[model samples]
Target: MIGDAWLWVAVEWSPPSYGLPFTDQEFDTPTTVALVVAAVVKAAFLWLILRAPAPGPMDRRTKALRRLLYLTVAYDLVLWYPLALLLDTVVAAFDLALWTSLNVLFLLVIRWRSRALRATAGTMFALELAGMADALLDELDLPELGSNDAVGFVLALGGAAAIVLTVVGQRRDGRWSRGTLVAGWAFVGSFALMISVVALADMLFSGGLVEGIALDALGLVPAVWLAATARELPTDIGPADRPPARRRELRVAMAAVALLPIVALVHPEQSAHHSFTGASPPCYDQPHFGDLKPSERDAAFLCQARIRYSGVPPIFPDTLPDQAVLAYGRALCRAKDREEEREILTRAGSERPDSGMDPWDLVYVCPEVVGATRPELLRSAEEQKAANDAYIAEANARCRDPWPRTKGVAQATANYFLFVDGDPGYLVQDPGDKAAEQAAGLAMDRVYDDDTLIGVGGSAVLVGHVEDVSDLCLTVKAFRAAPPRRVAGWDYVNEVPIVSRSGQLTVPEMDGGDVGAGAPMPNLAIRGKGRYRLRVYVRADDSGEQHLVVVFPGASRKRLQLKP
Candidate 1:
């Protein structure tokens, strides 16, 4: 019941991301609305549970079923009230970490003897797995181990163990009754269908509220299917004296039903994957890619050209792979594609969405992670400290002096200033930023509520309301102190914390281009990059917009860091 949307409406709340990455992109209108709709859906779930037919009698199996059903429903409805009441107004994020902890608790029933409960629990576990399906699939597809490989491997094993135990427990309980078989099939089968349907839906759509609702609506199918079929589920094993003759037929039918979703989901996803990465027609999709080429039999395929490539007419090189790893110790930008590594020409898919790892992680001093291929790659981690120092030192040699510096924050204008990466190369060549397209023409509250306007990934558009597609100049500033409650002759737009660890601010993501006001490094000289506060103040004049930001020092607290 309590999420950013509800709280924003209730208390005018906003996410504390400021200009930092990760925490940005949250509490958005679509997210909030989806949460609201989910709360309503969960409430509807409770009602539907009540509406579900009452149990036939009280057996160990029936008791176990009700135990889980009632207890989970209770916890789902009740667990958040205290958190919202006592803690700050941020909803606990929904991600792998939270899901792992919650599902791990279900292992308590591993010792229980009810096959029906195990089946249901196994089915419930599917909920989290479905959320993580693409991530798991992507990790499974990795040519070599990526950062999250361990977590993914462990979770896969843990979930498999829990499910296996359920099947083992069922086997130990007498021979399989037809009723037991039906119930087991129903529980597991429905979830299998749900996983495929939901995951495929994700691959197909990004229309925020509509996509979310459509996914949730698909969930009702499996849930209601399980409930409707619940009466036939008998936890007790063993055959009746006059068992039906056509047992094999029933098994095949359930197997077919369970496999239906997998086929439905994977076919489209694999097709889209081929379409996007290989520059094939994005089968079963509306137009998003640009370079559409005619394929066999009048079919069309689309190719991608990166926004940040340096070229005349031809934008991207074919060798530019989809992902890269900046091995700082080796001082190399290694392509993630195994084919690229072996000099075998092939294409790979983009980084999976909702995966915690970014396409570029901590990438201020590195070259284009995707495009570059270094002969000297995969060096030792021990060189990391020395390599970073040498890299920065070399950058210092290759840079110009007195990168853009501005002071005295607190302004009264309409320009929304931003914080971005300050790579020595970027400092020397201040290419313009492509601030988030979604943030354009929105209110200040909407910007802070939705984006980490104060932080830098690749310089994104600072959220500002505008009339037409007119061009504007942007500026950057850093602070080491907190802004005073009331500042002199300036209207406060927003303020949030920014932390610097390597004694440098990140440059916004950009390739070579002449931005009106190139994103130059701000000369905020200090001992090293440490945690600091950034206060954003704006004013609207055609005067280069240099003083759009101010920096304050020292932050009291750091907000939660969300991950996949």
Candidate 2:
């Protein structure tokens, strides 16, 4: 009952911006049915967690195991609640409070003779509630006692211990139902199997994609199996859901459980989202990645995968699962830059109402976790969308009417290089190699995501003006059959390879470093959409006269030649 109810909770929670289909769980629109279900489930969870084992032959052994589970759960619950409250995870605090209240009530109501059993049972109830709460935290990204391997191992061991207690009790009572046995063993099997695969994903770091799927399958199958078994379980069941001792089918079930690991091994190495786990401890004072179940980690990354800065600077080697918010802020909004950046950083420091923290944190942790402290360093969801959308619209307009606009030539000292794609167009072609993508030829595109070969896989040039870059106007015009001869007047200097996938090239493709407070250039492109041997030329100081012109088509062309 608790499992089924908790599953509903997972389905209902929806975080802001990354909300699920449903916007709220029980809180926002707490219907009578929801309230009723919540109360009953909470009660059921409490009862199951706290109730001590029925008096039986193995009571002593089972009692010892439950004690271990209880003590650990109690210790962690005490530590987790304050953080949960600060983070607005009221649900977590409520759970701890209810568990405490129940423990107090049980101690008072039960006779002193049975006080030991009641306390034991109360601890058990807390564990079950913790499991239910975990489902919510995973779905909602709430801060709490995170689900990790140690917890999983303990849970599986608990399940195994439950099976033993059930079997001993059922045989002693002589009415072990087959359904109970099957369900109990299956729980132990699936629980252990799921936990084992998660451990493997952790140990085999890069296999996230394949291993992640297997882990999900392992989690879901067990949930369903337990639900069905619980619904059909007979009267004698239940403290541990033990099955009959003499059933021959028991061997088959255990054997099946033994074979389950193979399924995980055969799947792809990791979860689909990351295809690999991000390094643990991605930063200081951060939770370890292991705290989240593999699926939860994948989901969390998916929620935060948007790259804020146009290009992530290479300095911060951090990867996904790190503070998704502050990813590029350190690179994009450093205070050491021109006055614009420095002023913003300084202003943010003065404005931050917090006691005292790194003012630069405003940039580093964009979409700050605690709240939207991003004054300007980071783009709020609204700003990010607006900026990207605006960029796309302008880019589209240019790609359509691509004639070189009559803008003043970038002064003699242009950016480091005006990299154009077509390297693969004139070189080898391999999709996996970031360098060889242009071989696929240019395909016009409207959408780009560092994927789409048409947008990626190209070449670059050390575009220069005389000593720096001889830009009368650096341009390329496509020639289907062949281009015209090199225009006269300009002296041909050297030949360099070029690749234009999407048949588009942009000028002053600044390396960013050399790009001073120059003209705020559009991040769009020029229309040289294919491979070419761009013949470099320089017009002698014709006294800066002759209306400097860099013409194409009047230039020779040939079908892209790939190096053998």
Best by TM-score: 2
User: What are the TM-scores, per candidate, against the unseen true structure?
Assistant: 0.24, 0.30
Q: Please write out the lDDT profile of model 1 over residues 367-456, one tens digit for every residue.
A: 244225431222323444356446444533432211233343321112222233321111211122133232222222234454333332
lDDT, model 2, position 501: 50
RMSD value for candidate 1: 23.4
lDDT of prediction 1: 0.36
lDDT of 2 by residue, 173-201 (tens): 33334644554565567666665655675
Candidate 1 regions off by >4 Å? 1-243, 268-564
Q: What's model 1's lDDT at 299?
A: 23
